[model samples]
Target: MTIGATYLGDDRCDFSLWGPTLDQVTLEILTPEPQSHPLGQDDWGYWRTSLDNIPPGTRYQYRLNGDRLRPDPMSRFQPEGVHGPSAVVNQGDFSWQDEAWRGIPLEESIIYELHIGTFTAAGTFEAAISRLADLKALGITTIEIMPVAQFPGDRNWGYDGAYPFAVQNSYGGPDGLRSLVNAAHQAGLAVILDVVYNHFGPEGNYSRDFGPYFTDNYQTPWGGAINFDDAYSHGVRQFVIENALYWLREYHFDGLRLDAIHAIYDGGAKHILAELSDRLTQFNQTATYPRYLIAESDLNDVRIIRPRPDHGLGMDAQWSDDFHHSLHTLLTGEQQGYYEDFGSCQQLATAWRESFVYRWTYSPHRKRFHGSDTRDRPPSQFVICSQNHDQVGNRMLGERLSQLVSFDGLKLAAAATLLNPGIPLLFMGEEYGEDSPFLYFIDHQDADLVEAVRQGRKREFEAFHASGTPPDAASLETLKTSTLKWHKRDSGHHQILLNFYQYLIQRRNTNPAITTGDRQQIQTQYNNESRWFSVHQSQANHSIWAIFNFGETLIQSPPAPNQTWTKTLDSSESIWQGFGPTAPQTLKGSESIKIPPLTVVLYENS
Candidate 1:
């Protein structure tokens, strides 16, 4: 059933609310007129009422049990804050110009993830639309936006969303999001929304008052797991599934990025991920463009991406943190916390060729043998990134790669992520090395909740043993400090870094060897003691070799492959603001080459 207000033409509207346990429900129209009407309950505990002459934009609430008033659980728009009335929105009224838009293929996706509130100074969806062309020009084929669901206040990392169906009121509500999606599709960019289904925000969540939306059967890092398998789970399941479809069908999103699937506990015969994936598959049968479901799982489990027929979760793809961890530990030499399991050239090479560094191997962090072999899975099933929100913001100080690593190290990291076999995802400003940190921020109305969040952040960083107090997550200054500086991309070394990123992306797209996405044709080797790693990829008769030196001093490398090679890209070249073109331009058998410190060099068979 369509929960919340559904605007029918001719100034009529139908409102439905799922109040399984309530003895009574009264529709109270708070705007345009003051009126109340009793709703009829069906066999399944859903109350429904239709009103004539109730036009769109009518603000209303539900009087539950004839006493307490609550906003619609599936509110489409919250004109006021989450504590205020929900507005009736006519979703069909918006004009979309994306009839000819077909979504980008998963294999060809170069995603750029951004937080709308921080992407621009205006901090609105419409403001974000002005920068879509900039991303398209940067070779970004897809835009993965952080969650836009309604929260208590405007500032947040989006995980604290409370109303699953309502567009954020502070971010311009439903119409603002629709306009952004429409503009993005017209700009030849596929837009995917990041959704948090594991837990609702601490504040403004009123679903429990209506029904059993959460259960104590299982516990999550946040609190009780969602009631996916408990009593009345059928209704809960449908509510979540319909929300996923609503975004794809109503808003015309290309896909959804499931946030932290590892925390979404479900012990049912049909896992929720598999069920959601099956629904997406069914939707794709007749969809104008394919819709995808990408999962963010830390389990390192291939079953998440494995086919449903094969008894797997059937996610289209999953983020592979092994690649990021390996690259990060190697570049920064950080050996504490989770980074303990990484920091070797061998692991970095393994992640490049195998997609998972801990494939049935011992993990010191977990003190157990973890992960399964993904050799049977294609490389496109994984998404790799050098730096993401979690990696940067989770730190006590929220330092970005531009702040932690040297300029040469940044270039090497970019090349490794872009040229790897898996799909590449770029964080908001990493392409031009934005120095601002992506700190975790939130705006909650409750004073106790604010203190709890501030303390939670401090305790979470205990492992890092970082000095200095973390920026208050509830402060407006923290959000402002996290905003990206757009002008930085056009000046001095930052501009050069931008050029280097463009060149690497172009090579990854046009070059046959790098574009194949074939793991079988790739070979990786590294010397742990020498701190050198090499990836050799080939497709048909075309081949490319990338040699990386993570050491601080120049090192000598053996001869090139049997065939002669011509230099293509050297991160240490003067074009990229490097000191010199230290590596030789051409190489053949019986000739060793000198590699500069903290540099990456590429060669194509001539």
Candidate 2:
């Protein structure tokens, strides 16, 4: 049963709400007479009533306990923003065109992470649709968007969204999203939506007015924890479950990337995450398009993606910060904050072998041993990225790797991430080395909230001794500055970087040994002081070897088992806009190939 207004056809409509603490609930219709209908509550804390022939496009609000008209908790559309009344839209009007669309599995995903607001100048779903063809051509099988849930004002990172079911009105709302998804499927691109389930945004969240949606017993980074497994929390649990189903079944999202499961603290007998996983698995059983769940967690517990039958959460995959941290530290040599735990070829090699460098190892940042070895899991179960919203946006300047590392270093980062056995995730604008930063921004109307956000942001940088004030979150300039310069795709060094990224993806997909997530097929060796490494891969008697140098000077490569080899890809070649290669054009055996600084060379043995 739908939690909001459901039209039963022929001028008959049914409205339902879940409110246990309220003495009275009035449905204030803004059309067909501007009247109110009193709802009867059930023993299960549900308030609902049937109406006949209510006008279409009617705006409504729920007046609870005789005061404060609140928007629907399950509002499909909120045209007037978060504080406004929810509008009823017909869900059956749209004609979907992708009847043959079957979603790409997580193993085959070459995910591109993008924020709609910064992805295009217009920042609307309709505008985003124009770029799908280009992404498909760029070798992206899936596009994982940062959240689109309706937040306050016009601009946000979408994590501040207060309404989970409502699409951001600034980004073209419900129809906009549905149309985008339909167009994406037609282009053979799977859409994975990033969803926030841990905590609600700070402002204009009215779920507490209707019932207990937050818990006092636990605290999260965003204040109170969600009321999962608490007293009268079953209804709250249903609300979250239905909201997830709404996206997958109604909007046809191929998958969901659950935001920060580490913060989704629930100490119940059955954790909410495990319960949600069971429900999603059930939904996937009958769904036309294959549905998947990927979790973003820091708790290095392999249980997140482990099969449900193994008594673990049955998520398809998780974002691997350990992989990112190891790669980023090695590339840039910046050992600040969490990066303090990683900075050496050995750490990167550990991530390569076991998927977590800190797996039960002593962590300098956390001040304790963290993570567990995940060797039993396939490499595809981890999604690794060189840069993402968190790695860039949370910085004081929101600087990308392009700004932090050398030109050759950029290509090296691309090769390491894309060529890894794990799934590779590329942040928007990263393919072309877009110079603009992805800053954390918001458009809240509350002055007090804005000031508090500014002060809190400044304090966060003190731990790392980061200087300079972050751009004001409330300023429109902050949002405008974060927008991608799409023209970079057509010119100069930027165009070369784009081609380099495309080449990396092509090589990864074409190599059978690389595509198969088998750990035994890969061998990694490195020298921490020399800042050089090699990954030798083999499958079905075929073999390919990749050597990477991260130092600023020339280095000697490890000899190939077979002396004769042909160059497949080289980041140091002048064609990809890197410094000239230091190695010979062809090798006949046991030769020490001269590897240029910050370069990657892939050779196929004959």
Candidate 3:
């Protein structure tokens, strides 16, 4: 059923809500003098009303059984706050100018994930729109926006969303988000929104009170698992499906990144993910441009992205934690937590050849036999990243890869990320090496909940034995500290790093072997003692090679392939602030060159 206030015509609106178990719900309009109207309830317990007095831009709420008014679950504009009345927005009022904007394809996507609250100082959609040209020129094809749905307060990471349909009031509400999407399309960039479907935030969530939106049978880390297989699940399923459609249809988002699909517990005859993908496919066939859906899952299950005909959930792609953890541990030599399972250079080599390193193998961190073999899957079906929000924000210190590694180490991470066989994703400020940490922050009102949050945040890092006490997550300063420092991008080593990243991305697009995203086309070799690896890619009579040295002291170079080799990019060049430029050398199968201590080099061989 179509919920929320839908503007019908001049000075008229149709308000509808679904409540199968609630006894009463009255429509309260708070404009042009307050008035209450009785909504007629249907046989299925849906309360609705058509009023000629209510017009667009009107503020209204539903009073439940003489209790306090509650904001609409599917509100389009929460101008005040989640606890306040919702606004009536006219869908057809705004002007759109993206007629010529065809969306970015998933194969060619270089996504830049950014939080609207911390991306810029202004922290508004309109302000963010001003910088799309910069990102478009930086070789990013897609911009993944963190959640913008209205939460409880002005400061949040956006995962604590309460209203599924409403835009956050602090982020300039619905019109602001539309403006950002339209601007992004005009700049030749596709916008992907990160959406949470497992559970709503602890504060201001009224779905449980209205109906069976949650199930007690399964518990999630955040809250009760959303009811997908339990009684009265049809409505619950419809609510989620409609919510996904609402973002794509109304907000004009090109894609959605499903957050924490691992926590979504559904055992029904038809999986909720498969149903969502089918609906997206139906829309993509008729839409102007293709829309994609990505999942952040830890299951390592091939069924999530496999074809529907193969009896698998038909998602477009999923994030690979193995790739990130593999790169992290190999680069830093840190063997704590999940990193305990992945310190070998051989594991990094395996992650590049296969999407997962521990497929059907015993995982020391998981303490169980985990994952299915994903050799048959396409490489583009996995999204790989060296640094992202979770890897950085969830840290006790919220330190980025920049803080933990040397300058040469940072360049190696960037080269491996771009040259690897998968879709690449960069966190905000990652392009320019923004050093500001991406800390976990929230602004909750309840003292008890806030204390619980602080305790939980510290407890998760106890195994790491963090050196310092973590900042209180409830502090608004924590949010402010995470904001990007735009000034750091144009000077010193940061500028050189930025230029090097742009060059790698350019090669990724122009090179045929790198562009193909086929794991079978890549041949990898590594040595754990030497701390070095080589990636050789060949396709359609074209071949290129890249070697990364993770060792600190200069060592004898590994044997180069017997061929006519031409230098493409040498990270040891003085231009990149390395020791010195590598002179052209002849490799007669047994020759060795004294290369820089820690660096990377790319070459083309004929």
- Best-performing candidate as measured by lDDT: 1
Q: Residue 179 in model 1: shift from native, Å?
A: 1.2
Instruction: Report lDDT per candidate.
Output: 0.90, 0.87, 0.86
In angstroms, give how far residue 52 of model 2 lies from its true place: 2.2
Candidate 1, residues 490-604, lDDT tens digits: the string is 9988999999999999988877788556788898878888899988888888888889999998877756667778888998888888878777888875577888899899988
**What are the models' TM-scores?**
0.98, 0.98, 0.97
Better of 1 and 3 by TM-score: 1
Q: Rate residue 190 of model 2 by lDDT.
A: 95
Off by over 4 Å in 1: 589-591
Report clash pairs, candidate 2: 11-53, 563-589
- lDDT for model 2, please: 0.87
Q: Mind giving the per-residue lDDT tens digits that candidate 2 earns over 1-606?
A: 678887666666789899988999999999756888889999999999998867556789999888878999878888999999888777776799988998897888899999999999999999999999889988999999999988999999999889898899999988899999999999999999999999999986889898999899889988899999788998989898888888998888999999999998778888887888899888878877679889999999898888888988888898889999999999888988888898998888878766788778898899998898798899889999899999989899899999999778889889888878888999998999999988889999888999999999889887679878888888889899999989988999999999998988888778766756778877888999999988877767566788889888899988865647778898878898776877766776666788988899988753
Give candidate 1's whole-model lDDT.
Answer: 0.90
Q: Model 1, residue 362: displacement in angstroms? A: 1.6
